[model samples]
Target: MRILQIHNFYKQAGGEDTVFEQEAQLLRAHGHTVEQLTFSNNDVTSTKAKLQAALGVVYNPQSAGIISQSIKRFKPDVVHVHNFFPLVSPGVFWVCRKYKVPVVMTLHNYRLLCPSAVLYYDGRVQLENVQQTFPIKPILQGVYRGSKIETASVVLATGVHKLLGTWREKVSKFIALTPGAADLFQNSSLRLRPEQLSIKPNFTADPGLGAATREAYFLYLGRLTEEKGIRTLLKAHSIKPFPLKIIGTGPLQALVEEYAAKNPLVEYLGFRPREEAMEQLKRARALIFPSEWLETFGMTAVEAFATGTPVIASNIGGGAYIVQHQQNGLHFSPADAQELASQVGLLEQLPDLAKKLGQHARQSYEQHYTPEANYARLLQIYGQAIGATEKPASATVAAEAGL
Candidate 1:
């Protein structure tokens, strides 16, 4: 099969970018032809560029022309889009409809439902916009990038598309990373039909099992952002001082550095390469995922599971969905420092329980998150999309609606 993948990259690379590349590579390795088209936020640095990007957030004719040319040349079996926020826009979906191509989009984040994309902002999981048609509250509060104008632009774009029935009628299928996420979107203002949504969790290549003997410290591997519950992790450590090693850099790096300086139990090991991070995961007693928001998927937690290390995740969102409490791993209440500390102490006190959970974590990785399993699911989704009837191109409707 020939596939075309499209994505708009953020200034900083993230999990969505990683998943996009990994899936394309997975398809190619399995004897499928793959082509990619990408746009970068790095090009939207200047004031004029930012203004133009905001103006074209709803529809970019240039992007439509480029995709039209690609479709003409590649003649792909299907088009899979990962992200198309500011630059790429929803216009490409209309272009695909004109060409009669099936488009499968992965809901890596909640960009369609929430402007911030994570359903989180102001140091908490903000869900006020989830059910709002225009998301007036988020726009008033400048929920996206702390700029009211930017937030309004995003709201306007999604709102306009929503009114035009683009999300419901144009795309062939939407892939949610977890069942919880699927439910969230189904109930959101998008009002996506049950048949339009498919659940497909992100996968990580196995890093092999860890050493038999584990290290004393617990591991926290991800961006050091407030939404990641970094403050909660620090407070938990204060409640019960345990050897904690943090690996990753973000806005809260200085706070982490200062805390590490004062606390003997905490060790700050800035951003390390993936190989080194995996090595740490293999040796740690457990991985701590205390994200405060509703994450689409916890890739780091899955990586820890692949390394045969159990995770102690906050009992909410993707963390709650992935880690089975007391089975593959443990779950603590979201943002509850005391409960988080208790779970950490429990792991330290009960070595046998930790061992059992680690074994189960490895088993879970094999059963759900392996490349082979993901490939089969991806092919199934693609087949379903291909089998679905294509909606005819309506030039009159497009011009009348001005979409």
Candidate 2:
């Protein structure tokens, strides 16, 4: 298969960018041709650039032209879009339709429905805003970067595409990172039909199994943001029996460092390279994933599973589905410090049980999150997109005439 992969990378690289690159590599490893049309947020600088960029967020004619030209030149079998936020915009979707191309969009975040894109606001999950046809509350409250103008730009862009039937008509299929995430779209005002959505989790490179003997400390391996329940994780240390190692930095870095200075049990390791993080994951008793928001998919949780380490995550959102309580791992109420601390105590009490859970986690990774399994599923999705029977001839004719 020849795939034209499109992605708009954030200023700071994230799991979504990692997944986009990884999937491209996975396709190539299996003898598929992949071409990329990439954009970067780093280019948006200065007052004039920021204003122009915000306008482009609504619709970028330049991006549409680029896609239209790329489709004619590359003649790809499928156009798989990972992210098209501020830079690429939804104009590319119209271009894809114009060229009679099957576009497969990956829902890496809730950008389609929520301006904030995290489905989060005011230190909590914003399911109420998700249910609304128009996300007025987010705009009013200045949800995106605490700027109403920024939030309005995203909201306007989303509203415009939605009215144009861009999602329902232009894109052939939508890939949700989890079943929970798929359900969100299905149940939302966007109203994607069951057949329109597909579920696919992010996969990690197999890091092999850890030693049988595990370390004493637990691991937290993601950005220490407020939505990640970093505050709750810090509070849990008040009753800590075992040590905790935090391996990332964000807005809560100073708070984590401050707590670590006072508490002997907490060790803030800052940001480490992938190899080092994986090494820590392999040796830890379990991964503490206390994210408060409805994450699309927690890649760090899967990374831990790949390292033969169990997860103790919040009993909410997509990550909850991955961590089966008392089976592969355990779950606690979201943002409940006491409950999280108690679960940690249970793991420390029963070494045999923790080890068994870790074993199960590794097995789960082998079964669901492996590259072999992902490659097969990915090809199936591409085939489905290519075989979409609803594409109209008018779209192709429009492109032929440069309409």
Candidate 3:
């Protein structure tokens, strides 16, 4: 099958960018023809460019034209979009409709439902905008990038599209990374129909099982951001000092450095290459995923599972959805430092139980997150999208065309 993949990359590369590239590679490796059209936030630099970008957030005619040209040339079986926020815009969907091509979009974040895209900001998970059509609160509070103008632009874009039924009508199918995420979007202001959404978790190539003898320290792998529960992890470590190794860099790098300086057991290893990170995961007693927000999917946790290391994740969002408490891994209340500490102590105390969990974690990876498994599911979703025959609502199509 021939596929055209579209994405707008953030200034700093992220998991979504990685996933976009990985899925394209996965499809190509399976003998499918794949072509990519990408945009980068790094290009939105000067004041004039930023202003123009904000103006085009709702609909970019140039981006639509580009898509139209690509579709005409490539004649792809389907167009799969990963991210289009602030640049590619919802206009591409309309272009696909014009060309009578199927469009498959992966919901890697909550950009359609929340301005911040994570349903989190101002030190917590903010759900006030989830059910609101205009999301006035997030706009007023400047929930996106700490700029009210930027937040309003995002809200305006999504709100306009929602009003036009762009999300519900233009796209052939929406892929949510987990069941929790699917449920969230189903209940959100987007009001996506059950049939329009499909659950497909992200997958990683297996790193093989870890060594039989594990290391003493626990591992925390991901960005050192507050939403990632870095503070919670630090507080939990303070509650009960344990040999903890943190890997990644973000806004809270200084805080992590400070804690590592004071605590003898806490070792903060700055961003390491993927191979080295996987090596640490393979040897650790357990991986700690303490994200406070509703993550679309916890890729690091899945990586840990792939390395045969059990994860002790906070009982919220993707962490809760992915890690089965006391089965494949353990779960503690989100942001509960004491409980997180207790779970850490339990792993230290019960070496045999941790081993069993690790074994199960490896099994879980084999069952759900392998490349072969993901390839099958992806093909199924593509087939469904290609086979969809429902005509888009005429009024909605006309409304979008007027934009």
Candidate 4:
């Protein structure tokens, strides 16, 4: 199969970009001919360019034209879109429409429905925004940015796409990384075809880190952002009987270090390489996910699961999906220091129970979240998207024209 992968990457490299690259490698490694097209937000050079880039995020015909040309040149069997925000809008799917080629879009985040993909307000998860009730979102964003007009423009860009039904135009299937995300989309106005929607979780590089036996201390891996709730976790460390090891750095690094100074149990190890982080997950009692936002998916939680370490994540946001309560892992309220401390504290008291949960988490990984399992599901989805009755095309014939 000939596959053309398109992604408009944000300035900060993230889980979506990593997932895109991994899928590309998976396809190519499996002998499929894969072509890649990428547009980076980093391309904007000046204030004028940045302004134009921001405008383009709302809608960019230039991006559409470029994507159309790529489709013409590549003649792929189908177009697979990853991200298209702040540039290369949903217009790419429209471009695919022109050629009459099938399109398979993976919902990496809620960019299609929520303007601020994190659904945050005042530096916290605005739970009300999930089910927006009025024009107040725009009103708030305008005031939030210190200008009514500036925020309105950004809001309009995202709003226009939703109003125009751009999200549903000629798409063959939608790939969601989690079942919880699929449920949200199904309940939304921009819902995908039930039969066409598939759930495939993001995976990690298979260096076999999960095979190692785990130890005592808990681990918190990922960015130290306000959304990640690092401050709450650090405070939780103070009351903890068990030690909590912190990894990764972000804008909140200073706040983390300051708290660590007064708190003896909080060990700020700074940012470690991915391999080292995985090793730490393998050794930790449990990986902690204390996110304060509606995380699209907690890649770190899955990483912990892969290491046979049960996760103690906030029972909120996307973390709630991967860290099943009392089954594979335990959950605490987001940013609740007392709840977090209690949960972590429990692991020390019931070592046998923790071990059982960790083992269950590892089994969960093997049962549902492995590379081979994901690839098989993806193949089934791709086959269905192209209107192929069974697995393969059942014949090798060129299309009426190039993609």
- Could you give candidate 1's per-residue lDDT for residues 1-403 as a string of tens digits? 9999999999888999999999999999999999999999999889998877888889988888999999999998999999998899999899998998999999999989888888887778877778877888788888788999999999999999988889888888888888888888888888765667778899998889998889889999999888899999999999889999999999999999999999998999999999999999999999999999999999999999999999999999999999999998999999999999999999999988999999999999999999999999898788667766444334432222111
* Candidate 4 off by > 4 Å: 127-135, 142-151, 191-196, 209-213, 388-403
Give all candidates' CA lDDT scores. Answer: 0.90, 0.86, 0.90, 0.75
Q: 54-167, model 4: which lDDT tens digit per residue?
A: 677666878888888888898988888998776777777778877877778888877555555666656676545445422356455663245666555555665666666665
Candidate 3 error regions (>4 Å): 390-403
State every prediction's TM-score relative to the real structure: 0.96, 0.95, 0.96, 0.88
Worst 10 residues of 3 by lDDT: 394-403
- Candidate 2 TM-score over all chains jointly: 0.95
Ten-residue region with minimum lDDT total, candidate 2: 394-403
RMSD (Å) of each candidate, 1 decimal: 4.9, 4.8, 4.4, 5.2
| Residue 260 displacement in candidate 3 (angstroms) | 0.6
